[model samples]
Target: MRWWDVEALMPLERELFGDTAWSAEMFWSELSHPETRWYVVAENPETTDVLGYAGLLAPGLEADVQTVAVAPHAQGQGIGRGLLDALIHQARERAATSLLLEVRADNEAAIKLYSARGFERIAIRRRYYQPGDIDAWVMRLRPLT
Candidate 1:
């Protein structure tokens, strides 16, 4: 992801993730991190407006999907799926044997998306989220490699 995109993504991050949204600086740092792999701004192919973004961090054979979000107005347009597909592809290419991520248990939409992508719940982190004290579902997907 480029530095220019961080400004645009920050608003969407706040809208979708509320208190969990990462700051622009965090995005910039991740973009430059050696272990971070990010795919940002999927264009319309014709119009070329950025539709979504996804990120992953692979420190070793295990990878963690740090975040994935699509524009609020662009939801349900398959942009999320495309971004997720790219993340999984990158993980495989990086020789990551397993992919991991934590999702708010209350976020059914996100849970469904991850499950459809073959991430199975392996554990639960009780009270993992603040304010509401919600649980986080820890999910993992094994790569074919």
Candidate 2:
């Protein structure tokens, strides 16, 4: 995603993630690592509105799905899937042998999405999300073959 997109992306980030939303500085920091990081923003084909976004960080043969989000109005429209596919493609391009991600266990839809994409639950982190007691599921997806 371009630097210009961060301003537009932050509101959606807050809307969806609430208190756990990332800050502008965090986005900036992630963006600064272009060699190891990749991020994409999905825009409305007609209106050019930011519909969703995803990010991946690849260091050597290991990669992580840093973030993925679809606007409330844009969910179930294949945007999330598209974003996810893009991330996988990016990881593959970087020769990532495995990809990892953490999803809040309570987020069933997200879990289903990742599961459908072949991610397997590997572990559970006890109350990983702060400001409340929410467990997180650590999931892994092996080399895309």
Candidate 3:
């Protein structure tokens, strides 16, 4: 995602994730990180307004999905799935052997989406999230030969 998309993405982040939203500075850093393999902003094909974004970090043979978020108003419209597919494709193209991610245990929709995309629950991080101290489920997907 470009620097200009940060404003639009930040608002969406607040809507979908509340207090857990990533700051503009964080997005900037991720975009500029050398380890970041890909960061994409999904826009309306016709209007070109940013609706979602996904990021991937490759630090060796493994690729980690740093984030995948869709605007609250745009949820259920296949945006998240599309972004995820793009990120996974990029990881595979980079020769990443596995893709890993973490999702809040209470996020059923996210869990379902990850499962549908071939990610399996591999472990859990106890109290990985703050405020309410929610647990996080670690999931992974192996690259297909």
Q: Can you write out model 1's per-residue Cα lDDT over 1-145, one digit (the tens) per residue?
A: 6788788667778887798788988888888875556555665678756667788897779998988888777888888888888888888888889999999999898899989989999999999988689999999998634
> Best candidate, lDDT-wise?
2
lDDT tens digits, residue span 21-118, model 2: 99988999999999999999999989988999999999989899999999999898989999999999999999999999999999999999999999
lDDT, model 1, position 89 = 87
The RMSD of every model to the true structure, in order and in angstroms, is 1.8, 0.8, 1.5
- Give TM per candidate: 0.90, 0.97, 0.91
Q: Write the per-residue lDDT of candidate 3 for residues 3-114, one digit (tens) a residue.
A: 7888877877787778887899988888787555679999888987779999999876899999998877788999999999998988888788999999999999999999
What candidate 1 gets wrong by more than 4 Å, as runs, is: 44-49
Clashing pairs in 1: none
Best by TM-score: 2
Which pairs, if any, clash in model 3? none
Question: Backbone clashes in each candidate structure, one number apiece?
Answer: 0, 0, 0
| lDDT of model 1 at position 57 | 91
